[model samples]
Target: MSKRVARIGIFIALAMIFSYIEVLIPFSFGIPGVKLGVANIVVVTGLYMLKPQEVFFISILRILLIGLLFGNVMTLSYSLAGGILSFVVMYIFKKLGSFSIIGVSAAGGVFHNLGQIIVAAFILKNEKILYYFPVLIIAGVVTGILIGFVSDKVIKTLKIQDFSENLK
Candidate 1:
């Protein structure tokens, strides 16, 4: 239990750092609310390195900490929606067995955007936000591919010989 908690803590820390790093970069698509999703690397890594439940646990911690540190209550909806949706997609990818991290992360990106859209629609009580879908999907493609590629490189360099190898 302590080991799992420690892993979750590590993920939260990395996610916070990446989230803050993104804030400093100030890069955005013209679409109002889009980001590079740099912190997703940690989520993707958790999905690949541990069980689905463990990955979910790490994700909840990361999202909570990241949101608390960088955002207020309103922004929490976006992160919560996006984080949960991406985690689900990553779990599906984990089940599929043959896809690359890039593919899986791309899926995560799409789901993340979709989740935010869902939340925006619910919170704002408007369906027009759905129009932002295309731009969000494109942005996801760009960011997700990059994050996944970087994650793959990092995982390779870490030399994790098997899925459970890093569990210890």
Candidate 2:
């Protein structure tokens, strides 16, 4: 139990570090809300390597920590929505076990954007926000694919399944 708790702590820290690194890099593609979502690499890694409950816990904890450390209320709202929705979609896909990691991650990226946009629309009370949906979707796919490939390599190279057994 302590090992699992320690692992979750480590994952949350890594996710937060990645979030900080993302903030350091000025990766603007002329889009307002687009991000490389480098932090999601840790989330995806958790999905592949940990149980669903653990992944959910880590995702939310990372978001909360990032919010408290680096963001404001609006950031928390948007990120909480996106993170929870993305986690749900990814969990479903993981359960289906039909899609490749890339597919699942891509779906998660798209859904995350959608979730945040939805929150933005609600907060701003402007349906025009939907106009950005298509572009965000494209960005999501690109970032998601990139994160997915990196995660796949990490999972394979590290032999996450074998490592999971040791954790057990």
Candidate 3:
């Protein structure tokens, strides 16, 4: 296999590991569907380091693999909804080229939660689930910022841009 393919495989593995780690951690904040978004560190890194399409590929692959490994049909559905929406939002922000990584990631995080909430509302058939929006927004911002900072550090320390060039 080519080095590029190998690198992508490595990234996917890292994302899956992160997802498993997040599951292992009991980080309930008294609100359902709130998470620290640890796997997003890989997603954000890919957004900056890989092609847009490649990033989407990695994100979707990770979500599906995680769902199969650790979740059921409902988990897969919710994850798919949140992951797709988050990826779109982040891609748009990245294309705009105005927002810093933190800003883009923050928006992505917020929208990710929003997407999941929307799915939950539809699944439950209750508008009351929307009440979680405000709290989720705050959680998203916090987790997004955290993920962004970590991604930034990883990008800089690893020289991801330079490495990406080598991969190509």
Candidate 4:
């Protein structure tokens, strides 16, 4: 395989490992389901370094890997909705705006939760699910911003621009 493809694989594997780690660090905010999204570091790094299409591929692959390992087949719908929405939001920001890495990452976090809420609404077939929208959106906004800030710090401290440039 090409060096570039190998790099992609390595990052994907790293993403999976990070994701599993997130799963284990359970401090659920007592909200049934919420997280700090540390695993998003990989996604943010990939987006900053790779093209839009490549980022999309990484997002889907990571989601699939996580779902298959710990999630049921029925959960694919949630992953699909969340992953696609998150990618679209981040890609739009990166392509059309002047937001830094953290900004895009934050937006992706919000978008991911929005997507999952949507999936939940559809799956449960209940309009009451709309009630959770506000809470989840709040969670998304806060978590997104936090992770974005963290990613920003990581990028600056780690000199990620060099790697990003090479990957591109």
Candidate 5:
């Protein structure tokens, strides 16, 4: 139990670090809600190594922590919506057992953007925000593929199967 807790702690820290790193990077597509989402590398890896519930917990915790430290209410709300939606999409894809990490992550990224756009439209009471959906979806797929590749490498390097076995 302690070991699982410790691992979850590590994952949260790693996710936070990735989020911070993303903030440092100036890469942007001039589209709001479009991002490399490097932090999702941690989420993708966790999905493969940890239980779904544990990964969800870590993801939500990371979002809350990052929000408290560097964001306001709006940011937190957008993040919560996107994170929850993306996690659900990714988990479903993973459970289907037909998609690779890249596919699952790509779906997650698209849905993440969708989630944010939905929130934006709702909050601003303007349907114009939906116009950004297509661009964001493209960005999501590209970034999701990249994130998935990195996650695959990380999983292979860490021998996550072995770690999961040890935990079991």
Candidate 6:
């Protein structure tokens, strides 16, 4: 149990590190609210390496930590929505067991954007934001594929499955 808790701590730290890196790099799509979501690589990896609930805990905790450190209340709202929605979609796809990690990541990315869009629409009280949905979807799929590929490699290279089995 201590080992698992320690590992979860590590995962949260890694996720925060990735988020910090994203802030430093600021790889934008030349559009507002479009980000590479590099932190999600850790989330994606956790989905495969840890239990769904553990992964969920890590993702949410990371978002809260990062938001508190670097973002405002609005950013937190958007992130919470995106993180929750993306986690749900990723979890469903992972449970389906037919989708590749890439596919699951892609779904997660797209849904993450969708969640943010929903929040934006609600907060802005304007439906015009929906017009940006298509672009976000594209960006999401592209980033998701890249993040997924990286996650897949990380999992295999680290033999995370083998390591996590011991946690069980």
- Compose the digit string of candidate 4's lDDT tens values, residues 42-142: 77867766667877888889889999998887677787798899889998998877987767877898889999888888889998987888888888888
For each candidate, the alpha-carbon lDDT, in order, equals: 0.83, 0.90, 0.89, 0.80, 0.90, 0.93
lDDT of 6 by residue, 1-168 (tens): 898899899999999999999989998889888899999999999998888899999999999999999999999999999999999999999989999999999999999999999998999999999999999999999889999999999989778457756656
Error of 2 at 56 (Å): 0.4
Cα lDDT for residue 89, candidate 2: 94
TM-score per candidate: 0.90, 0.95, 0.94, 0.90, 0.94, 0.95
Q: Worst 10-residue stretch by lDDT in candidate 4?
A: 159-168
In angstroms, how far off is 76's CA in candidate 6? 0.5
Per-residue error at 157 for model 2, in Å? 1.6
lDDT tens readout by residue for model 1, 25-137: 95676667888888889888777676678778777877787778778887888889999998898788868988889999998998899898989998999999899889898
Ranking by lDDT: 6, 5, 2, 3, 1, 4
Off by over 4 Å in 4: 165-168
lDDT of 6 at 80: 96
Give the Cα-based TM-score of candidate 2 against the true structure: 0.95
Displacement of residue 31 (Cα, Å) in model 5 is: 3.6
* Candidate 3 deviant stretches above 4 angstroms: 160-162
Model 4 alpha-carbon miss at residue 72, Å = 0.7
Give the winner by lDDT: 1 or 4: 1
Candidate 2 C-alpha error for residue 112, in Å? 0.3
* Candidate 3 lDDT trough over 10 residues, lowest sum: 159-168
Query: Positional deviation of 72 in candidate 1, in angstroms?
Result: 1.9
- Displacement of residue 150 (Cα, Å) in model 3 is 0.5
Task: Report the candidate with higher TM-score, 2 versus 3.
Answer: 2
lDDT of 3: 0.89
